[model samples]
Target chain A: MTADVQTLASESGCHLFSGCGFPSPGLNVFEFKPIFSIGAFDFTKPMLLALISMLLVIGFFWSAFAKPKMVPRGAQNVGELGYLFVRDNISRETIGKKGDPYVPFLFSIFFFVWVMNVMAIIPFAQFPATSRIAFPASIVGIVWVTYLVLGIKNQGFVGYFKNMMFPPGLPKAIYFLLAPIELLQGLITRPFTMAVRLFANMFAGHMLIVTFSVGAWYLLGFHIGALYSATSFIVVVVLTAFELMIQALQAYIITLLAASYISTSLEAEH
Target chain B: MDGAAWSSVGYLLSGMLIYGGIGWLIDRWTGHSALFLPIGLVVGIALALVLVFVRHGRSS
Candidate 1:
């Protein structure tokens, strides 16, 4: 709906002084026409971007570490720095010595999400794949299953539930009231919030940029409105820079939370 | 610490959902308007706070 309005606005040279109203971006901005269809499924732009992000992550790391060098150089140096950043700052900080085994997982997750989010400002591919809830929800599903399985493996089936639902040192009489809350929090709320956090951040960031971009375009006239357009353009640039930082910060936060969840599963939380 | 903070949020949300839901059902069964919903929400928040303190705050 808004897409058609945007097209009409742009094609007809609609501006602040023009008879046509502002072409405001809305939820419709997130909707993309399918590029192709295979039977029941339709291939879309976000899906393609997500696929490219995954391949980019895999290809970069594969080439970087394909041939080990005692003295790191070029891509290897950059790759090692990225790898060590996740290892030391995120994984180890959250999961301790046992985190070494999961560094690869965390590294892949961090880079993949970062790349997907960075796509928002990358020229033609100006959309963050993580803005789509399905992407983040799927990642959260994997994390959810991993921690659940780890908890069962490490603490045994009953022990895992017991540890999760009944925190030690709580009053015995309150267990009945608190147990249900704990179970629901761990089982449902954690994954739901994790997915929503990433999706909402990217979604809001994209929305803000698009709003200002469209505003800048819509306000460009041969009058005082041009000044407002320039200001809107400036806001867009500032928002883009802010989003870059948020993208990295969100990636770090999600990965950190994943590591902590894994750590909690590996050993019952005290 | 970040993990703990996030967990506290989750606890509070789930507490509200669970208890507030129960309250809504009770209101339905008893035909009392707005009687239990607010009460349930308060109880839920209190319980969530207690749980948060026991799990995270006590460590310090």
Candidate 2:
């Protein structure tokens, strides 16, 4: 099967490049050699990007809010805009008035995801840290644990499970059929989709950018191919702009979903 | 509203995964092919719709 796939791939590559060696890009680009290792720990490009993104977030927020300004200026003004954006747009919109307390959590997630995704466009660090499933999976894990704990804490263990598995006001007999789905969705699919949604977006975005970039380079090899190279370069430019919007939108969506889950856990009924 | 819509998708996906997976297992066990998959998919969608209506369609 692997050989068949490779043959088909090479055939397609030849068809596209008219027998020229196109040097088609693949998943190999995502793989990286460890820069240095600390025993079991391996530091690589994506890991470095993640670390840098985290430090940037921390430093930016620290400078913005570390000193409380009665009249906001400089970093405080910028920080307030980000804080208020998350508070009003995501948290309050999703969770209502009581969402003020969770603003910090949602805000951090939104910006962290946004900055990590934005790295895909940054020169020299052209990789989205969230493209690695581990990062989004870990974030979703934290979200899962948070909402689960909140539900059990506020509603009691048995009550929370009951409320989650069996929606109130449903007919008694239908609960048997629906219970499994509800349980599976709540326990498994919720976090799974949450992580996959972000990871898949970043992964696909990175793949597209890489493909267009390589296409442009390969097409520029011949005089007649210059037009194709120019077209591919234009696509690369347009896609980069589009990717910027998607990165921010995905961050907003994940944070909004987190808030929604938290609010659902807190509520007595769906 | 958007939250409800997104979770509704989760409901649909989980419904299909759980029921369709069980159907596939049954097919494997019985050596029957393609028989249960369609049934599972339809039932999954039906149940997901009902759940969505209960969660979002009704006035709270």
Candidate 3:
């Protein structure tokens, strides 16, 4: 059954988008010229989609929260829910007592990311903005820079450098090897991984859905293996439910991790 | 032989595990939990492209 489904995906042509003879899993179908480039930076189709999604999200909530009703109605409620979710659930949970001050910043990150991921599920406009590495990486770079700048800004350069280098409560022998290694990690690896997490998950998830969707279409072609084809129908249904859960979970995870990073940095102890 | 093929498969998975181990080390060092995937995909892909298109193929 699995073998047959695999064969279906390989041959299926749903005409969703031109994938440049590459296995795009049918996500990026539209082609557009680059808008502008600053030095090495080239803005492409994905960036445009992200911008539009940002506008749409802002517009939706602006209209929602423009007037504060006595009893919260429509957009205000939704916006408030978003703010409360990240502020209370994520920031407080991660950062504990000191979370209130950082609530606004974390709320912005969480919503922007969640909205970008939700863009994929939006009908007619089916693009996951965060799937584009540039968008997520840019956000990650921002967060990484925030932590570095804030850490140094709050704790003087020497103090922050020392804080990162010799994390409190490490064995004495380990410091010899750990300091340079820790510095290297702080300087390089932190931001790199943060950006990649959102990029990989959304990228892979979208591809998988497209692959299966196209496979389902492909299987409807043959008569003899109709029973197995029916399973594709079932599989799609199951995967959709799983994908919805995962989509939200991934956004929560990204924000949760970000808050936790901030929380740990705020702590003097490890 | 078939044993060599199976051994190579084992080696590949183990390599991924080891790579992940190193990544976890970086995460622990930096106090940032999620940090490896972006480095691997975005920066790593760019590095590969530079290596291929701009670096190796170019001359001093």
Q: Kindly indicate the candidate among 2 and 3 with the higher TM-score.
A: 2
lDDT tens string, model 1, A6-56? 554656677886788876777877888899999989999999999999999
RMSD of each: 2.0, 4.9, 13.6
**Second chain alone, TM-score for each candidate:** 0.94, 0.91, 0.50
Model 2 TM-score, 2 decimals = 0.91
Most accurate candidate by TM-score: 1
| Reference-based lDDT, residue B42, model 2 | 82
- Give the least accurate 10-residue stretch of model 2 chain A, judged by summed lDDT: A1-10
Model 2 spans with C-alpha error above 4 angstroms: A1-19
Give the candidates in order of TM-score, highest first. Answer: 1, 2, 3
Per-residue lDDT for A1-270 in model 3, tens only?
222234344564422233323233443333335778878877865687778867877787788778879799777888888888888888877678687888877776777787788766565445577888878888877777777777777777888888766755546785564455455445555455557777888877666665665555555544644555577668766766676777687678767766765764675434
lDDT of 2: 0.86
* Residue lDDT tens for model 2, A18-132: 6667656677667777989999999988889999999999999999888888999999998899999999989888789988888888988999999999999997788898999
Predictions' DockQ, in order? 0.84, 0.80, 0.03
List TM-scores for all candidates, in order: 0.96, 0.91, 0.69
- Name the docking class for model 2: high
lDDT of 2 by residue, B1-60 (tens): 667877899999988987888888888888889988878888888899999899888965
